[model samples]
Target: MTWILVLVAIGLLSAVLLLRTRRTRQKNEPPLDKGIFPWLGHALEFGKDAAKFLTKMKDKHGDIFTVCVAGNYVTVLLDSNCYDAVLTDTKSFDLTRYSQLLMDRIFNLHLPNHDPVSERKRVNQYFNSSNLSRLCSTMRNNLQFLIASADTQNPTEWKKDTLFDFCYSLLFKAGYQTMFSTENDNTAKFTDVYEEFRRFDKILPKLARRAAARDELKFASSARKRLWELLSPNCFLTGSVTQSWMQTYLQHLKEQGLDTETQRRAMLLQLWVTQGNAGPAAFWLLGFLLTHPEALKAVKAELCSLQHLPLDKTEDTPVLNSVLKETLRLRAAALITRDVMQDKTIKLSNGQEFVLRKGDRLCIFPFLSPQMDPQIHHEPEKFKFDRFLNSDETMFCKEGLQMKYGTMPWGAGSNLCPGRDFAVCALKQVVHMILTQFDLELCDCNASMPPVDANRYGFGMLQPDGDLKVRYKLKKHN
Candidate 1:
């Protein structure tokens, strides 16, 4: 009986080891690091600070290598020159298919008709380039109404709030209104939506890795469900008439034969996608301007000259555009990923060929490459407001390199953000209004830039690690 019990224990141990086993790397493949843990692999370290961890790996393996993260082998391409090897290869690498991994494991939100790949077409149409001016007009109207007279009219008295809170809260409100406005505005309802979104946002990293604690998962689940209820079609049917981008998308979803429940879930997904990055971006842009007096002065001078230009024409305000570009270069972080749909050979521009295994993942982190590489960007740590501009006021030629993509806070390829144009308009409008319409500054003028929330490295538009105290009041002339 004792021998039988001992054999049972050994069998259990053997099964555990079998489940943890990984495949061996073949010759000519990128170097592989399985990390210290069995299944978790480099997940903990990668999550802690992806920039630091990936940088360390790049130092050891040179630009490209494979590493085991969680249970998957992810081939990371840090060479700016080699990004096209993945981004351009439609036949071998597929990002749309790769999105299913996120959907299945983390979100558990089923894509309608099981086809997010084709959903891109619908999304593109909603953000059609031809209607860009109209969308910009809608967003500008919503944004100004949110920030104007009622909140900032008291020019004599200063209002104090942390910069992050102010920026995130306002952008969420305005973006929400543009996409999902109910006829008569309800500040209380907007506040409730923003608060719940913050709750969900705080847990997204853990949730994505499937490491969220029980309570965190529960709260995130509840927050998501509540958001669906708040944005449901019945809310509009009850009397608050509207035809916003969200309404347009929902109408499209309905045409696709999705039920009301499915449409609600899709609305929640839309809310998450459309509203997440803008606020963090606005906060970082404002924070950079507040901390850098020279940049602030340059943007102010540009604003003086362009008082009559349409807010939609951000390109006309070159100084503001340059500063925003500079801020994003330093602050924005995104991970471009594709599923290895087949056993494929990727050849870098330098003629190094690596054969990727089927079932592996390919990743490109531009933030670590051209965005911060000393070769591509001098003084990469410092925010140079004119970095994207030349003395002739022509756009800087990607630091003299013949590059296809540069300063891509928005991604590339077919999946590149559809609303990217609107994003530029919205961010520029916020910065323009704040700088021109009010008296705003850091409460502690000497406060330095806060550390980035490194857990958010692969996520777009990182939030600051801590908040900066700031005060603002409406300008009397405005």
Candidate 2:
């Protein structure tokens, strides 16, 4: 009887383990696949290359399916047409908790009145598309000054460095100065900030996932602390020309009774959000243009004709816009993630329905379908500078399933980036200034394009795994 009882206990324990480790699909749910691993299902494959893994999964199971990843079952939506069902449904979906979770995980940040919705609204008000005159004016001045200051040693002499390093470093400095005012264009000070930022950014993905090893965690923690010190309230307040938005944000934080430390952490988060993507984007845009000679010629021609600060984006430049559109489509890969607030059935625009369970995650990898799918974009992997232009160059190409927005860089609804217009203006500013004000070219024209760092598939701007050597010199102003 004792032996039988022991056997029964073991059997019951095993049953409980199986129940905890596995999942069962209820009616109307998406196709579920819990991989062979007990708790870490398909995490290895997914982490290795999310795009490739998701593509394989899409082939195996239709456009939508739930796969267990790192113990969480995430229902991924691949159909571009169906993204609205997820983005607009505030009652059933929530991203604020997830965003806050990342903040604590990555930045060690916790706010008193942590309301992202209200915060985003205030941010949008500052970054309003209708009136970006102040920010745009400052950004242009900073860009020109920084460009001229970059190589005071030799105006005509060609300076050489890895292109990605040059682009990101310069743009980051300019963007930093534009957002957080400084008494002087202290190149050394801002460059140090960008260096520390780069260090923190490299390990950010692992940090967010709670998967950083000993060395990575140590580096991230140290780098973040240093960043906090650099952008501390004292340093930030001393700046004479702090943007209005910064002033408003600081006042709001103080109203919430946040301490100096909390406010500093908040500033760091803002830095990451505002100054992060533009540089990498500039890198990709310039890299593509340099490699493609005809594209280089066309964009330069367009810049030559511009008579104003903000070129009538509605009518003036088509070639430059197309090139930018192509670059973003190829390089931007953001994983739109949301928490399933309740058990809700999501009906796709195509009329397919799938039930998402409460406590599960919903993921939309637009980079896979709408952005890079060959069916939607012809020769999707190849860079076609004119891919988005009509034959007469009157309208951007919006054929196939792209009845709405062709690419999703800013995402949708409340999660839609308020800084969208400003970011694009910044990119165009960088490209226009670089091409028209400086002479740049690849060191080795025949060398292959650098491979993208696969680890950053879900991150916003996809950085190249390897760097390309490039040379540039200041062009004589007319």
Candidate 3:
């Protein structure tokens, strides 16, 4: 009877503690949509359509709110007014934790907790202004070789092809050759490794599940193993090819005392980073130009002006530059995320402030926020080719404000992409080659713009849901 009495008292104490904890949470935390599930929370709703779901939430909950996704409360900042607070307060907010989580979950790679400052500095040097300028000719030559070898080079007849596939193939081949391998490297071997990489990339979102399932993990492991074989120092020790990015990175990893397996995984991560955005961006730029006749004509006129001029002066092609910028604004879907390292108050431009708790993630949806603001971008949904260009040959502004963070395709602040200049140069070179070498048109003029792949929202530029059919023939210049 004494033991029974003790158990009853313990149960009553537990109930009281639970109620007190709930009350404290209700008072301190931002409004969280727990959804219907016990712990799954908003995962289903978010996975179904992230952009639409977030938009609906923004309408109901204002700019700042929390959603319980997969048992974590993700605080989203959906207004450009709050961007400065996130960008400037690096001490309170950090990107490394979020990046590490993504690499661990999606890419199946584990990284060290410490900062890789030296490694980052070395990588940045490779993509500096001088190196990027020197690489322009290399990029152009690669594109030229691919185009000349393609079956579409026959000027006598138009060749039909899918835009995404064509762009992916061209960009992948050119980028891989230029950045990852030496001139004398075996093309067939590199192509095999690249194909495997694509397979792994396609299943990244499902990586956790696949890793648990034996059959799926088997395929993924085989692909990774083969990639390791190609990138390992043993294979390249005697090769005549000059050191590429991967080789240099491998040397760094060895100096840092990482095992071969870990080094290979790091190389894989680098490969994904280098190739992720450029291909999709190229596809959208060319695809949009093909579908919009007036825009195409204007850009073509701009291209004609550059006939006698040097291709090295990419900035001189104002119309093409504007088109690329506008495309980035329209299509790039990046989730700029930072972890709240300590409890802090964020001051907003609208004279409001919010308290962020430690261990919380502060996320900025670039697509749903500044990029789509009607005030910032008039007719935000429409593709205005020259929307970014001002009368004085500068970036457009909103409400007499310069709008520095209005459209962040390569992101902002310290975490901005190191390879932004290289990427832009490569993209410009690709478009230049296509415009100067090929006569291109959409096979179906009435085709609508393909839907963005919602699954890829936070993974750089979203790919089209379906490929656009296009026809091309060699352009005959007198």
Which one wins on TM-score?
A: 2
lDDT per prediction? 0.79, 0.82, 0.74
**Model 1 global lDDT (CA atoms, 0 to 1):** 0.79
Q: Give the per-residue lDDT digits (tens) of candidate 2, residues 36-83.
A: 987678888888789999999998997889998877889998877678
Which residue pairs in candidate 1 have backbone atoms (N, alpha carbon, C) closer than 3 angstroms, thus clashing?
Answer: none
Error of 1 at 88 (Å): 3.7
Count clashing residue pairs in model 3: 0
lDDT string, candidate 1, 1-478, tens digits: 9999999999997786557555678999999898888866898888889999998998899878999887788999876666655676777888666666666544556664556556777678877867777778888887788887447455567899999989998889999988887675598899998998898888887777777889988998998888877878666543434367776777677777878887787777778789999999999899989999999998888887656448445567888888888888898898888889899887765668888988888989989876877666678889888887743323223435455555667766655778888888889888888888789999998998899998788878898889999998877773
Give a tens-digit lDDT track for model 3, residues 1-478: 9999999999997775444334223444555665666445677777656788898888887778877666566788876756766767878988677777777765557767335444567878887766766666676787778878785445658888999878887888888777776654776875786688777766564563222356766766777777767666654443554466767777777777877677777777888788867788999999899888888898888877664325356557788888988899889988777889998776645556777778777888888877887767779999999876643313435556455566778866655778787788788778877887788888888986798877777778888889899998887778
Candidate 3 segments exceeding 4 Å error: 1-30, 113-119, 151-155, 208-222, 235-242, 307-314, 391-402
TM-score of 2: 0.92
